[model samples]
Target chain A: MSALLEVRDLTVRLRVGGSDREVITGTTLEIAEGEAMGLVGESGSGKSMTAKAIARLLPAGAGVEGSVHFAGTDVLALSGADLRRHRAKVAVVFQDPRAHINPVRRIEDFMTESLRTLEDVPRAQARTRAADALEEVGIDDPARRLRQFPHELSGGMLQRVMIATALLSRPLLLLADECTTALDVTTQAEVMAILDDLRRDRGLSMLFITHDLELAGAVCDRTSVMYAGQVVETSAADRLHADPLHPYSAALVQARPDVTSTAERLVAIPGRPVSAFEAPSGCRFAPRCPHALDSCRSTEQVLTGLDAGRVRCERAATLRGRLLDPTESPTESEETADA
Target chain B: MLRFLLRRGAMLVATLLVASFAVYGALDLAPGSPIAALTGGRTPSPEVLAELNARYHLDDPFLVRYWNWLTAAVTGDLGQSIPLRENVSTLIGQRIGVTASLVALTSLIIVVGGVGLGLLGALRKGPVDTGVVLVSTVSAAMPSFAAAVVLQFLFGVRLGWLPVLGTGTGFADSLKHLVLPALALAATSVALVTRVTRTAVREELDKEHVQTAVSRGLPWSSVVRRHVLRNAAIPITTVVGLTVASLIALSAVVETAFGLNGLGAYLVQAALNKDFAVVQGISLVLVVAFVVTNLLVDLAYALLDPRVALGSRAS
Candidate 1:
């Protein structure tokens, strides 16, 4: 399948006072049409910045570099009127709905104006479409909701409203950056279910950015683990879950809470991710990786192609060879492999 | 709402009582009595002094004198001005219309010009924001009298575009004379109002809802006008309410400097000549103005935001 969106050597630099420093270094990735890719990282890992860069939404003080090819057009190269036209095909949902909603505006104005931006529909027709969008997201009585202020709605409802607004544009790519992190767990699950249903029904391509690996695993078809300012690993979701090759990815999977297992103790990653300002020289995760060698400390390991995946580690090939087969249970591996 | 009004009314009565007492005490403690001042620091004959004392209720105890003055004040029968011998009520009546007009015009200028400039400075950002901020700071730093003098020199004396002093002309000409004084009074309030407005808008700009507007492909103009300004205006209303009373204080200085026939000028003249009844009458009017202004501000606060009313009710 051809890639729907290809981000190649994307770099973002931000100016402080007069000096420029890179917020995101050269990074590359591809998303096939109807694909869902999860970008997993802690805050300040440039995951959100990358998603924003793709949407061309960074503020005036920041500079972006790279080729973001959406369909056949270089999104980063689009300027002025062309950029405004391109906005109809792409949409983003922010992390907080309350912060994004206009306090004085009724919900109808917010939703209908957004629809008007991409189409020339009459006000009534646009409002009807907004109501339909809200209905699709499970908001009851959209008519009553359309008259209320942002403060009148609950956090979950507001987020759902934001999602509805995004869906109204019929965007080719949806950039959702930690969209459900502010929500309660039950609400988050409900939102995720709605998003999953929408994607399946519309075949919408998405780049989902979040710090929660479980959340990413639940929704994304493929998961890319990010460290500092780089994508360190990418693997198909089921394959990655069954046998993660990179040490960082393996640690993340192991850290998942096993609700089924009656184990008395839970495992966690030992240390924090390296600071972005002083990102490690070689493999970015080498300092935190248990399998690090002297060569791991010296070599700048790039994401080289491996078995059905890519990993940025000097020992990923050898580690893949030693990985337990999918047929083998973890209980058997626990007897043979050392921590 | 009724409870809010009741509470505000009680506070108003207490504020008026305290203001009355202070006025009575200050008038009574003056070096020479109104009687002696009227007699040019010369002692009158026993019979004349006795008649003057009884007419002014000077022989009564301090509290009785206070009670008499308070009663007459509430009844709109404030004896008479010692120097002019005109009824204090009539003198106050003559000056109030002019002062009220000036205050109303100045208020309109502040709301329209000040709020507009503040919104402009906030939306423009960078140098435009900095320039407005700097100008407001300078105005806030300079006293209202200095502003009045400077404006008088520029617009009145130097340009010969407007009259330098006096405001007893017809309404139109009074406005022409009132311009310099009004600008002087409004400068400080406008500076304060603009500063508060800018701070409020800047804060609203950082909120998540504004970010949502940006993400929706909305124009910056629509976002600032609709989304940002309304959210910013809630706190700005409180700042405006506080400025109302200070506006009168500013009016007093400007009116005196420009020789306007307003209550503020009457106040200065009364204090300078120690005309106790006029001083007491003018003080009572000012106190009532302050209380009424505060009541109106509370009402405005409730009207602007239902949530404030609801929250107050809950507590």
Candidate 2:
């Protein structure tokens, strides 16, 4: 009820080899008003697909089912003018800044194109507003820069330009799909700060998708961890760091490189990330989870309350404090018993 | 930019010079003399034959003769046409207007009309796209000569709606006659432009910028005009340039079929009568046209793709 964007049991099936294979299976998420939700997952884990489906930007042949309700309006049912209005309201800043902006067009042309075309904003006013938007995103010499093409700018600068252009429509929800992934470490932090500042200043809702756990924890109000195309666990950003509910979340936390760790080797996940097809009939992460039991492999997962947000696990209540020290190796006796 | 253009200009000069040498050498090695063509191949006394050879520098050494022609060509003297009994430049020059007009019309039909259809086909995917593909494939498969014959049969003989030969008298009348020939010349290239342009537009449409534009609430038409077409222009320009160049040579078949006294027809006649000066001069012009066409295509390509243009300049 508190959410601005509520994706209810959304499922996306891609046509692969003449059959519809569900890439995102009933994945649900919500972003509250003026709040940022971090969607963290490895590549092919359906993080992008979920965001694209919500934005109605899925390619032809992608079958989308389930309801996506934004501001109490059915997102899936909107079309024509309503759909365009929805798209303008829900702006997306993609992963690669260069990939998403026409290289042939000047920054001014790109920034003012939508505003002038869609809203009938006067060209001069649009240009002035574009300059201001650029200035807001820490871009200096906005006037001079606007005349330049995307290739003329650095990766970070191009990303800032993208953000500036994205804000021209004055969207309510900014879907930043790894907007800083292609940037260097320093630029990534700057872009994230710029995004955070803009979100707070404009009172906007954001769905910040990225694989960087630390970044998500630091920037987002709440974090949702996806596995095999489903949100395995979602909790307050701070709580996700201190105590992750699901095993996959815990494993992801353990795999993060830490400066203070005293272990001989870094903790690694048991296997490669799985696609929806390779996912099991039961708990999707059961094969990779170190704490998996015989029953865990055979039973379907359901969301169970853990903390501020829900987790997809059967024994969530019982496994409370036991999953804390995820990096600690199993005892010799435990390995021998399994053998 | 100046440096790039200068380099291309230099390349043009070098190519023309090389072409002149090839044209000169090939004609020398070719059988039959300019004497036979000028004298109607009748039995001539040795003294008369010697006089004609000396007059045309046919008896001069290869290097001296080529050097002489090269110098004269640079000064706008393209040698003498033995068959037409006039300056090679004047003979080709008079008909240059006709051929140039034809080639320009064909290029227009291919680029504007063909690419417009291509864009429409790409924008509308189901039946419209299928129809465009089917039409383009059929057009591409139809040879220019066969196409000329077919167009003549349909429009000229049966319909009597158009002229079957000649460049016509006035502008409008000329255009009337130009239709079938232009269509015949344009068919393959129209098909080529349509297919390549459709592919280019489709590829550009798949790019994330198009998606970005759409997501920003811009209509697909606006997105296509602003983003997709601009990005697709480079590849389409390349195909059009190549097609035009190839069309220049292929026009000979169309010209002979229609009995037009254009460069293509002149070339065929010169080759048949062994009018080496006219043949050599026309060949040089065609080579220069092709090179210049490609050069312009490259320039246009650089404009569309700033990476290559700006990157080289930046460094």
Candidate 3:
């Protein structure tokens, strides 16, 4: 009835070369019951780091501090049996299916083992459930597919298997980190559609992390734009596209190419993303923002907004009246915000 | 596969031919004649020495002598041992059973014990495991001869549980004498195999698939044997194959220690008495066994892992 997963004030730091390198800065977000949230950011924007933190899959060197509340359990406080029980509730579908499966194991055995292990189901029951899950993920001929090995299957098919294995647990939250980035365009679409259908059918919430803003907007109910390890803006998927308050989000939206529209050249962001160790003191995006005032350079902005959807921008006051209509179709004729 | 076998067979034949030449050359290089050795370095009359040399084909030029020996070898006639006054092949045939039994037992000890202890140490990863690895490393560091002497002192002289020497007693009793030698021979191999298995297993544990399994909440044991162990086996097979050559060489020491009438002992006796035929036969047998064992190991690698056969694309 309420939020399915809530992440609050999450920060993760690692000691690298005698310095405390913060990989994920203080960021807060939530996914409501049966609602999907897209977290869009470039490679070093801490999107994947945040997802791994939520799953408690960080390497040994990492130090995590935050409360990830999923299904009323404080994910950080849970330990031992409590932690394991909560982990079973939040499943992760990694990017590479080959690295995620037992190479020597047949697809059927691997799937059945995964299903049985997470749920404590009997072997025979697990096998039946695995086939059913594979079918749910739109794999044709589930029986034969199960018999095949990971090496024998295509990347898209393997990814679907990973998704099926994750879905078999009936998890409340699915953390998918660039799950289709390694596949071809056609395979990506097929896998995405399968995921979309599975999410709708199961009424599951997903934290879909990716670098593709268009794909995120197309699939997510809400989108959170992240920059250099902080959530810079959050709005309804359509609103974030039309009225991007944060300069970083605006740059991201501006960078996307439109096949149906016309632009002399796609405007790319000026610089590569700053490394986690070199994150700026003030607003991390301020250096790149053309609208940055003296205050934007001197002081860090806090995430503040009247609605749950917020933007960490000091220029929010000036930008509020200029916001575009969320329902406006993505056409070049729409208001350019011209900032 | 057929092409591979054909190439291997050709190479094996060439290697044997080269090896035969080396053995013949060594015999030809010996300082004194067999006639002199038999006559205790006496000045044998020219007619008598010439008659003996002609009988043994020493009168022919080196190439002709070698060619005659080669053709004679093909027909299982390796001339005769002057000192023993016996057919060279019959002497070898009589002695080969003892040598083969010794080599076979030693090989069994190495392959079985080494792999078993290695798997154990890798899995346990405790003090006991550490102890096994430590002992193996130390044993591997020592030469087989050194290990043989130490084992002989402990088991043969002090323990008095087994026979002391010379393939003593009945077949079972002779086997009992071989046990200590075999154990000594296997000691290093066990250490090596265990280390290999442990390293391979530990590395496999860190693989992403292993983490994926853990994330699924599968029991650790199932993850290891079903996934990690099988993948770890590829490298271990390579090491095992390479070790066979050493294992065969180490058998020489074990055979000598027990005074068994094996190839190593026969070769030594033949060399001392200037019995060229016995020396040649022993060398040929050793080289053939070494090459054949290597070939078998390579074949096993192909069988145990399809990736090696399929050019790693299957991986």
Cα lDDT tens digits for candidate 1, A1-339? 799999887888877678876777777788999999999877788898898788787777787777899989999888765776566577788888877777567788888876675476798899899989999999999999987877789999998998888888888888898999999999999988998888778999999999898888889999888878888789887677677878787877777778787766666767787644568777777777766776778888877888777888777775674443434333535434533
Using all chains and alpha carbons, the TM-scores for the candidates as numbered come to 0.86, 0.93, 0.79
Question: Mind giving the per-residue lDDT tens digits that candidate 1 earns over B14-53?
Answer: 8899988998898788787888778988889999999998
Question: What are the per-residue Cα lDDT tens digits for candidate 2 across A1-339?
Answer: 389999988989998889888889878889989999999999999999998988899887988888899987899998888988898999999999888989888999989987898899998999999999999999999999999988899999999999888877889899999999999999998998998898899989999999999999998999999999888999999889778888888888878888776778887998889988668988999888876777788998987667677999886665555676645555565445544
- Sorted by DockQ, highest first, which candidate order results? 2, 1, 3
Higher lDDT: candidate 2 or 3?
2
Q: How good is the docking of model 2, by CAPRI class?
A: medium
Once fitted onto the true fold, the runs of candidate 3 whose alpha carbons sit more than 4 angstroms away are: A17-20, A72-74, A77-90, A102-105, A115-149, A168-171, A321-339, B1-82, B85-141, B145-203, B254-262, B310-315
Cα RMSD for candidates in order: 4.3, 3.1, 5.7
Candidate 3, residues A1-339, lDDT tens digits: the string is: 499888998998978888778988887999999999999998888998888777776766788887888888887776665766666777788888888887667888877775665556898788888889898888889889887778889899999999998888878889888888989999999999999888889899999999998889988999998888899898889777777877788778868887888988887777678855587788788677756666777898899873547899887766553434335333343224423
What local lDDT score does residue A208 receive in model 3, on the 0 to 100 scale? Answer: 93
**Which numbered prediction scores highest in DockQ against the true structure?**
2
What is the lDDT for B195 in model 3? 84
Candidate 2 clash pair list = none
Candidate 3 chain B minimal-lDDT segment of 10 residues: B306-315
Candidate 2 per-residue lDDT, tens place, B1-315, comes to 888887778878988888889988998998877787778869899999888877777787899999999899888889887767789998888888878888999999999878998998998999999999999999999988999999999999999999999889889998888889989999889998999999999999999989988888777677788889989998898888889988788888888888777999989988998888899889988888888888887887788777777335431
Q: Is candidate 1 or candidate 2 better by DockQ?
A: 2
